[model samples]
Target: MTNETMMQYFEWYLPDDGKHWQHLAEDAEHLKAIGITKVWLPPAFKGTSSNDVGYGVYDLFDLGEFEQNGTVRTKYGTKADYLRAIASLKEKDIVPISDIVLNHKANADAKERFAVVKVKPDNRSETISEPYEIEAWTQFNFPGRQDKYSDFKWHWYHFTGVDYDALHDETGIYMILGDNKGWADSENIDQELGNYDYLMYDDIDFRHPEVQEHLKYWADWFLKTSGVGGFRLDAVKHIDKVFMKDFIRYVRENLKEDLYVFGEYWKDSNSDIVQYLEATDLQFDLIDVMLHMNFFEAGEKGSDFDLSTILEDSLMKSHPDFTVTFVDNHDSQRGQALESTVAEWFKPLAYGLILLRQEGTPCIFFGDYYGISGEFAQTGFQDILDKLLYIRKYHVYGPQEDYFDHPDCIGWTCLGDEKHPDGLAVVMTNGEASSKRLNMGELNRNKVFVDYLNNCPQEVVLDEAGWGEFPVQAASISAWVNKETHLSS
Candidate 1:
């Protein structure tokens, strides 16, 4: 079976002209041609505004179908366009993963008087102010939607917290005071900042039975309406882990049992991630933020960084089966709130590490593949990524061998299975130009191997015992394949 690769199809700075969905529909064939088996689309629902990047989710039911957010079309496109894009992806056998932001709701339609207690930003568990009435923007009527799909009007009672006090003209973390209203169980949520249940805007209260049922209903409706094969759950660390696991189970049981679900835990420690996995019963995969941090540090530190230890203390090492490895993401891209972009010079090495490995399911960032726009514009690695992606789909296979003896230079090889005979060798260095004499297995003995990346011009003829020294450029990566395949391509 061919390897599965996912591509995050949008950047932080995609043009707000509302044509992204159309572009996706047009590019579905190209994406499949490039070996992308899945596409994680940006939030398809209506947001705070048409220009909102879908994270500021206003109405879950109004997926660019209503005019409540000053426009009928979202930053991507209209409801029709969004559906068409999903169809295109499905037609190409590509799984369309929808970004689901359920942690909070933004841009409420009206203000509702509610009693709340102001809490310290650093420590949400401690209330610094007395319970007082504040007119909070927690009423979401979604008038434009007019309860078309399901009349689920939200009020302040349904939420756990609100950030802005409209009547007092104040903005802070205000925990709503009501029956069963508070942050999610601390034991079930991240302990960061005492409790991290309230991320931003009006935090959703999953503890409420109505809220849980409503969201489950929404999930079913969303799957039916959007035709998405998978879900990229956003801000899961702040939500209740028990609820997340249950919600996924509910969706899969009622809808599709093979539904692909992954959450953006955004934690860097493998221990913290493991805790979440255990809490959620390992129902979904998590993006390897720890691995991304390693790439970021390696990119920033250059030669001083130890290349061999890149996978150390990462989810890839501890829980590779449930890890979605990526070098950079929308949050880690340039200028985003969680910005920690891997350096451009080091991307070749990072891409090689993630895409060529047999460990984790790799995701290619849109900003890295198609380039980022706006003030911090940067060139993309389209050419190199295309080469690496092709090699991953058709070449990478069989028994893997790791050559991480050196701190700055590391190499690995996939000895090739019966189906893919002329397997591949990969060598990379963070320091000077070098060669690593790696054994390519007896099956590949006496074959002439060439750098598929073409970064190095030399070719190596494997000896009778299948040992050949692979040459790589300084601070670069070379994906070596059989000479015959490289020339044919």
Candidate 2:
């Protein structure tokens, strides 16, 4: 919790003209001034093509350094520009987080014929078609890279599965069981579609010792080459939990830096999240999708929503230390698959909870802070977020008190402490205007409190017993801090 906030600095619809890294470098100081402590950048390695979003990981060793995959630069920028952006952010006391996609590999150097069988997508155990020989894209020699980093030449035996077969011009999940080896069932992959480990491209098998060694080597190379402070791991649920745990440990202990690591496990069930955390032994932080869904539902339901249940079934409530909460992400912003964007009116309230509360690290989406263009039109909430982050940096602290007894309006108080005298009081409503009596400590008896949100201009003064009347407008949020703080003075 060294810093108060993290920003997801890119949207899905952003054009891939290869200038985002330079833009990030230019906005380094501006981001710091706006109270952003860390930024989660998109994947920066060379993808299947020049215009690819860097997720179709072809060569982990080539960070836009060598000419490969039909280009010398990724969709973000060249290797030099990416490194400079990271340096600029470090200079401003901001950490740059890189997205690590290690579940599969694409854009193979060549195709190889292998014996395979087709299985029912719903029940992978039941074979839908008999065994046949098909040419799969399962070779990656990296001739362009020329063994400058590592000489790990990949062939059909390196991968356990591939989605496309070039020989028959057919697309299906074919298990690459060579020399009596099968997909890693011990990884305990998703049971929904049977074997969820094979997501896309040539799925890497963690069971293979060579595969694990190659990934570990790449991890070290990526961390050293990029000089990033942390990683946002992609598709953790689809990979082996044991391997992820080892990789995370290797990153922290091997680098000898106090780095942070977060994973994207997009499940709406709190129980599912809890299960995943247990499997990984809490090695990485998770983006609480269940909590985000709660916010979205609350916003959509409006007055009819139960404000008391806003924090219910949320990882922030049960596991605060490893919960990385977010209001919306690239998938939910516009036309993606999980497009359940929270209503605009409730963004302030949603942000106030994560930023002001005593639990979870909050992430502000790029679309919300800077506004998305071309279809998803928004003026952005930069001004509101600026004020909230200022409060978060200085005034929001100490033990918390919750009054989630109301269905439409609820509030919480953070008792002022010696470190930060006269802490904070927060109130928000999903329905009608309401009031509450929160007892600030007896030491705060004569202190006056003012709403920094400004919409609720009425100032409140605590009585001799330390209780004050707090008012909140309908469908809005009001955050009150001691008048003695910097803003009040």
Candidate 3:
């Protein structure tokens, strides 16, 4: 089904227990029942430490199998548990997508003496100091695995830089000038800082052939080892654009199975995302960050926000197919790094827009669906989400007609065919209680329509001309589907 409905399964603030994967395995059937076709998991491999949230990548091969970093299992779970979770999800025909972080590697085994150069954080191109000797923790001899997979050892040569220098006892960006190893930073990446290629801890040099082979090996190995449907690439802007394109190509070449790869570029500009798609020849679906920003802005402005401006600079307006629309993610949740929490009151409205719409692939965030852990208990969409999912899975159908006319209220209708007889109508208002006159075509004429969202709390009946007046509450939304339409997928 091409993952029409995607669920980002894990949130960043989840309790640091090595039991998440097991819990996810148990939650598989519920996910299927809730209309989730694809589930995206966080980084499975071992990070800097046992409690590390996986973005601080350590060993790609170690999926909680080794006794490294003070624990045998990752923060998620052991290797066996991770596999069982995927298997459980697969048993219900759900495609499991794993997160891939390739920009940097963290938690090295040993320190090596090397010549280093410091660069400005604002301007990476400008070398702030000359190359000086520093003991950088860049050696990686995977003592736990005992070289089970590829025996290629990582040293200062495989990477271009390190943050902490042991000998010098300084904390800054140090460009590693390995002996006889030329610097490899000539890839077209984010042009924010002239070149924002280097992101964090032990930045992998994409230009190096050996480094390239190792990453390719890991991608293929990961796919083969876990049999994951595809990947959700993390921090693509920090890595070389060419390298990312090649990695996807490599994954496709190795796995003859249909692979769906989408990357998180995380830019607030539609043009930049479109430009990255054009620049790398990488057509993978990107998370619509610009659209999320608009959603966030609308949530902040409340009734004052114009409904017409919602789709102004969104990828769904232009590149619909290649856009993965989401309300919030692990990074965007409250108290996280990209914390732009959508206002709680308007969450149902936001979820209604993404889930019920026909354009773009909608992703239900873990925090939004299941509620954020402990401290942020006030969040989550509650009963409205389950109802919306049912609507998205069953009622939403056919060719759409837009009625983005009013600044206060906007509505659209999906003209259903003979199979799904009475199509759907959606009316959303950012201002005080309003109603919109919309045509549902002759097929639905004189039929009783009810707001599935219950915000309207009123039934609408169409006239002989098929025109109906649908009303919604202030700063809320109303979705009108056929009163007799049965809920089934």
Total clashes, candidate 2?
0
Per-residue C-alpha lDDT of model 2 across residues 1-489, encoded as one tens digit per residue: 434589998887677788899999999999898778989998888888778877789988877778997899888888998999999999998989998899999899898988877777676656777778889888899989889889998888877788888997888888775675566574476655776777789988887889888887887777788889999999888887777888788778876357788999887788988888888888888998888999999889899999899988898998999999999988788687789899999999999988888688899998898888888776689989988888787667777899888898889998866677778888999887888888787878978998888868888999998789999988899988887674654
RMSD of each: 0.8, 1.9, 1.9
lDDT of 1 by residue, 1-489 (tens): 889899999988898999999999999999999999999999988898888999999989987888887999999999999999999999999999999999999999898998999999999999999999999888888888888999988999889898888898988999999887888888999999999999998899999998999998898888889889999999999999989999999988998889998889988678999889888989999999999999999999999998889999888889989989999988988788999999999998999999999987999999899998789798989999999999999888998899998997899999888898888899999999998989998877899999999899988999998999999999999999999987887
Worst lDDT run of 10 residues, candidate 2, spans: 180-189
Ranking by TM-score: 1, 3, 2
Better of 2 and 3 by TM-score: 3
Output the lDDT of residue 413, model 3: 86
Candidate 2 residue 90 C-alpha distance from true site, Å: 1.5
How much lDDT does candidate 3 score? Answer: 0.83
Clashing pairs in 1: none
What's the C-alpha lDDT at position 298 in model 1? 96
Candidate 1 residue 447 C-alpha distance from true site, Å: 1.3
**Candidate 3 lDDT, 1-489, residue by residue in tens:** 222798998888777889999999999999998888989999998998878888998899999998988888999999999999999999999989999888888989999998878888777777889878989889999888899887878988888777898996889877777654433344467877656777789988887888888887777788889989978989988877877887787667776348988889888888889988877675588888888888899999887888877877787887888888888888888777798878877778778778888888899888888787677654667589888888887767788898998787998888876566678888888888888899999988998998887777678999998999988888878889888763322
